[model samples]
Target: MDIKRSYKGAVEISVILLFTVMIFSCGKDTPGTIEPEKKNEKWRTTAVKDSIGNQYYVVNTLDNKLEIRVDNKEGKTIFAEVCPTIDPAEIPSEAAMVITGVATPNKYISINDATLVLKIVMDDVKIQKKYIQLLANINLDTKKFYTKKYKIEKPEDWTIVDYNNVVHWYQNTLLVREGTDYDLNRGGGFMGLGQRGTQLVCYERDFTIRYTKDIDANLASYPSGSGGQYIPINNFEDMAFRSDGLISRVQIVTSVEDEWAGKKDIVWQNDLKKSSNIPADYSVRITDYNIQGDEVIASYTIFDEKGNVKYKRTGKWALSNGFPRGYTTE
Candidate 1:
């Protein structure tokens, strides 16, 4: 009977020890134990095509990172990049959330031939208080990626006026934002009469990104008591690009009035290797004579502010050499 009791007690103790071990295992108190957060590990992939039929595969790693891949016409991988992750806590959430006139939840907003614009938003319930809006511009050919953060309040008040490569030969994107000029001084010192204008934010590119506040203008003298007047002269006007993605010609309004303006048209020479300015008022029209073998023969006519013909010129430009021969001037 004693041996039987001892054996029974030993069996019970073993069972109890097993149950205790099971309880401890089920709990999260084990040494070096960690519970993985599966939500953060979730990710999604999206594919987009550009205007030129290039394929772009974007993978939102869901960890504040993006994996991008670009494929060319033959489905050959041309470029790939793994963008650096951003800290959600460091981003501000109070600003506006509208992009390109629409409130988007994380997605590609624009896809040019060689550029991609992505809008990344982190507004999950867990991170609603720490919401973040990031605009990323990725260049497939240059293998460059840049990001900018915006905090806007009103959606209807702001608009993206222009977003594209002003000069196709140059791999830079020009972004123009149209909104209310909040500076009371710009509105003739009034509240509701704020000036509505466009601001040149920056040139998105791999290198040499330029930031400008407003268009280049002149401050005209005003009466001693009043603020000076702002007169916008040198403004970006019409431009043309060659079939080979080179700058053909660009016209700039040098003066508000053509009476005093000179050299208002810039013609790209030598396949855009050099530039020549037309010594006259702004160009009224441009005509392409011929394009062959890295050479462009073009003609343009400039007119004065009074609609009178000021100058006319015809030139042949080549990529290998600047104006190979003398051009005709009228």
Candidate 2:
């Protein structure tokens, strides 16, 4: 065994150990100091339509590349292999490549076609190239828009079978309107029985108003009636659906001149004691009744055009099926 180590040998070993320790230490490459490499984010697709009504999906991938595919009007894959070079910010970053419901009609795929991948790509990008598709079942383009809508609340109430498609609903409101008429006589001869002095006598009668959702409700045309006899709003009496769909509920609209309706005793309120006429500013709505446990009662409501509840009619509903009068103490 050596009694003492050589100074030269010790110095050489120490230098070697110092160099190893310095090399192992991560000075600038420490965990917190190093930043992460950014990933390519996806962007929503853009759509372009040609003159002949064809749609194409413009997609920008994560690696800053632009791609286009036919979204609708199949077999029109002329844009295949035409990957335009563009930044990813050209499209919506959060938007997924989608096939909107507007293209439902033009969706078509042939079984004989060998290529299952719809669009052909040419550019080599870092992002994973995936085919995305969203489709629709029914076609909405060719179907003619029908503006007629009918809301039939009860199953067997008033229905337009073949004339117009009826949409049924569970809750319905019945509107039964009654008005009063007057029979006047003048009394002068005998105990107010004979007519000489004027005496006002009155009785009530049914207004005979009808309800229909038809756009052509036989209400006289407006503006034409203005010059001829009545006010412009007085003649307009038709309603139609804004779009063709099954209507579960509807608000029947009516327009009338405030002065004319007031003077003519055309009471929208249907009150015998009080006078009610259509307001020029506010709207009048009466809910038609539907069947509720063998009972039908019309309900009415009046509100401003903004849907604020202003006035509500009494709950005195006309019962279709009830016990005979005087049977129950009201």
Candidate 3:
């Protein structure tokens, strides 16, 4: 009897141990309740102001750091830097910084040198900052190269205007190509073509620069051609020249053998109107015209249809992408 009781107690103990082991094993094997390893969901991000503002889309990878910068009225870049992409909401309200920048969360970001108003969202919290950086670089003479973060939106004439009358077209603003007239003095016969933002390239040297609206930045550039954008060069006509040395109108005479369309295409003719030069403090000059890397300036005069002067603005001429070395006469 004693031996049987001992045997039964051992059996009961073994069963209890087995049942406990099974219960623990079942807890570990449950599928739905298993926890997954933590991962980062911050990838593939974008900054959308009201779903329609300038979107700073993150590019292919997120390993790159953010670049912030500030530029003057011209498209020249100023100071730039790399920073951690923190949630703007996490920044202290008393934090001192300037951060006017566009963000591409997947890739990087670039900003101008100015006191910016940034509303950053990180971890579902919005943080704001002021005095993010030094704002005096606008007048600085520095040529800084920044990683182009902003994917320039193609310019559409009809879709981008504000009640205050601000136009934000940023693509194909100017075209540049090899100049037909080669100068022995200048090594590269490179001439830039400024034109209406519609076409990608300028076929001929004669073209018109139409600012869709009043852009007071006194913008200028030695426009360059794109990698593959072709331009039509048919139908040439002689147009009148404005008071300035630029052509007021041009005549397009279609070549018998159209480079674009073989066989004498439709004989097309178009007329150009005179471009009213607004009073500006900068003069648009051909590339290499200014020899001094430190000394070049131009002026502009904005006038109304009646030829009445409306406004006069001034900008420093920069030969080497640095600060304006000089200015133009009024």
Candidate 4:
């Protein structure tokens, strides 16, 4: 009787093991009918938008040759241009011609309509003809003035004389001044000099000037409840065109005192004025203090040679504003 019972238990265990194996085997093969791999789908595409709201789609294969599609409003595709084959090494870092991406060992075409080429190059080193699109031009009797052109289209090369005569090339865009600033005429439009999206700025001769910190002493003697009152440096933002003719550097100076009367309670530092100074002229004059109260407000203004104000702004914070924080660990 004992042997018969043991044999029955062994058969039951064998049946359970067989059922488990069949379940796993069935899972390995999906239930649906297998389809053949597709071969005709040769190219993959990705779409990007420029600053001007134009849409560009890039179609590419594994070997890296490209076809670009530019679409306008109403969803109509306007252009389909084939990009020339290029070696990665021959491309300039700021080449507005080449799209940029994370270049890997495989060297796949990662980005198609990237607008970063020209501006990126301008940021690092100077170029010869940095063509920029004309944003606006004023043909005055005295001097021609240009404004709001894009950076990509700035000229690559230029020669200026004593901040009076100017000449520069931005890509296909050009700005020339034959006489003094008063005699120059400032209206012309061009394309291929800037990013695809932004409104074009008018072109002008590249020039430079010396700037210094303008501080007020009497305004520096103010009162405070806990910490000393503020000192504003909103006037120090200045924009300068590069030697190549693109408005490249914007220098900003801020004034904030860390301690007052040896009491060190309220810290004063205002880097907040940097962004506010963008619209004003490259030369800035900041008024350091207020006459009514110890609370200081920095004022900035752009002026003509005769000191007529062209643009002006006021700064909000001092250097004492606490350090802002946020960063990704990865």
Candidate 5:
């Protein structure tokens, strides 16, 4: 009887221990590990009106920083709450620090525009210190407008040549390629209808430059090309932005015999893209040019087979794959 009772007690104790172990194993996940929280890194633009009813663009960053950029002023940032600490003694109202850039969340503080108006509002206390610091960069009357002329030297002894300018502000690189094609009938002189072919090669050169004036501090460049983003410009007015963008792509159907059609298959290396058959005699020229914010506006005249102006167009230059293809107005 004593042995029977001892066995029963041992079995009961083992059962209790096993149940406790199972319970502990099941509860292990509750406190053993933790999941981290994800952060939103998108930056957005906000617009707010100041005490005097002037509007501006203000950006609130993810890390509790505020960026203020003006159209013609130097940009300012408040990295810490105490650094841009607004003193209540100079307080005007509760709307001063409220920044309204664009409601859309994006990294750029400005609203897809060269011109931005930002207002800061926080408890109606004006973040005037930051605004005033940034404002002085624009209000200086000593600023002047300047222009740089790009001198593209025409190769003196080329048979036919074409010129194009590639302006990529984002890359800080300007590329110019001169496509020259020369045809020669050699080895048979005059009447043999000698081996004829079109020779094509594009001489590419870099023309990107930096502005040497103090005004460069007031200007801004756009981000990478994502298609359909305009580098705006109005031809009739003075430009306040970086540049006037231009891209022209015309359908050229050309049928040249012998050398050109026969040799290397006639390759085009410049901005002039052949839609169909591009003859070796077509030429394009740009006359009036203007750079506005986000768009390149210009006037171009195309010379056809007989050297007369085939057509003249005025509008925004079109782009393909971050490079200008032709003229576009829409």
Candidate 6:
């Protein structure tokens, strides 16, 4: 009987030990626990090739750093750089960045056969409600890097509007839109009331990297004595971009008092003088415009208060010198 009890106790102990081992093994495989192999796994990886058969690999590590590798056509590792954290998914395949008020696409990272341009946004802890935008241009041929930094203010109430497809990279020039909000009050004393509206601003930055406010126009306006009503006619129209992504031309409606005052002179201005190097005397009221090769053809019209088209003429301007010499108006 002693031998039998001893054997049974040993068997029970063995079974308990086996069960405990199984429980511990299952616990290790539970949802919250990280497997040994996956502990060092990467968050994401992206691989792309440029036009000249240069291979590029972008890896997003678990700690939010980007590991970028470039290989030449001969499969030789030519360049490698570790950049700040930017989600691999945000980078677009195209060369242009489109900020449509809702989301800013990864076109911020543009890679071409000769150059790689990166637009990075960094927070500024030193300044309240401000941020820094860094533009890094890398020459793939020479492996040289150049950087431009822009300090931008962050407004609490303003928002980005896709705003006629604003923001583009025109060769060495950059065009971007900045939006602002304004409060307008109509009437006087106790009967006065206030309204809010957004102003869409178009800014141009040349190769010198200086920002110029090209157009400061509103999306809508609440005219005084109009009972806080909004009108959309006082906005930008016919924004056209060149083949190289430059805002070739834009038309601004200075006022829409014609809607209320019966007969108001509607002025249309061509705001591309500085960018295109056009002369200031060039007529701003261009009606129809087209860009063909290196020349720009535009039409102008003059109308009487009775809505009669009094005069119509067409002119051709050269983009090379911004002169109306090659072509004549009809």
- Indicate which candidate wins on lDDT: 1
TM-scores of all predicted structures: 0.38, 0.16, 0.20, 0.21, 0.19, 0.31
Per-residue error (Å), model 5, residue 245: 13
Candidate scoring better on lDDT of 3 and 4: 4
CA-lDDT, candidates in order: 0.41, 0.28, 0.27, 0.30, 0.30, 0.38
Write the number of the candidate with greater TM-score, choosing between 1 and 5: 1
Kindly report the root-mean-square deviation of model 5 from the true structure over all alpha carbons.
23.9
Candidate 1 lDDT tens digits, 1-330: 999999999999999999999988877766557674453323433445554556765544455445556677677778666655444343224222211211111112223424344333335433222222334555554566665543323333333221221122222343333344233124453221333234444454442455434433342111110111111112342224443224434443222352145534443333321244433433345544544566555665656557787776676665333345546868
Each model's number of backbone clashes?
3, 14, 46, 45, 48, 1
Tens-place lDDT digits, model 4, residues 49-160: 5434445544443344444445655556665544433333323432343332210110011112122111113233333233222122222122232332233322322211
Q: How would the candidate models be sorted by TM-score, starting from the highest?
A: 1, 6, 4, 3, 5, 2
Model 2 per-residue lDDT tens digits across residues 121-236 = 11222221222221111112332111111222222222111101111111111121111111111222211121111111111111122342222222211111011111111122
Q: Looking at model 1, which ten-residue stretch has the lowest summed lDDT?
A: 221-230
Candidates 3 and 6, the one with greater TM-score = 6
lDDT string for model 5 (206-325, tens) is 222332111011121112122222232211111211122224221111223322434221121123314212356766555665444454456656667787866665555222212343
| RMSD list, candidates in order | 16.4, 26.0, 22.8, 21.5, 23.9, 18.0
lDDT of 6 at 246: 29
Question: How far off is residue 236 in model 5, in Å?
Answer: 27
Give the higher-TM-score candidate: 3 or 4: 4
Off by over 4 Å in 4: 1-41, 61-65, 86-330
Candidate 5, after superposition: displacement of residue 141 in Å?
11
| Model 5 worst lDDT window (10 residues) | 131-140
Q: Write the per-residue lDDT of candidate 6 for residues 161-263, one digit (tens) a residue.
A: 2212233333323333333311211222210122222332332222354433322233322112111111111133222423221223333322243234332
Residue 287 CA displacement from its true place in model 1, Å: 13
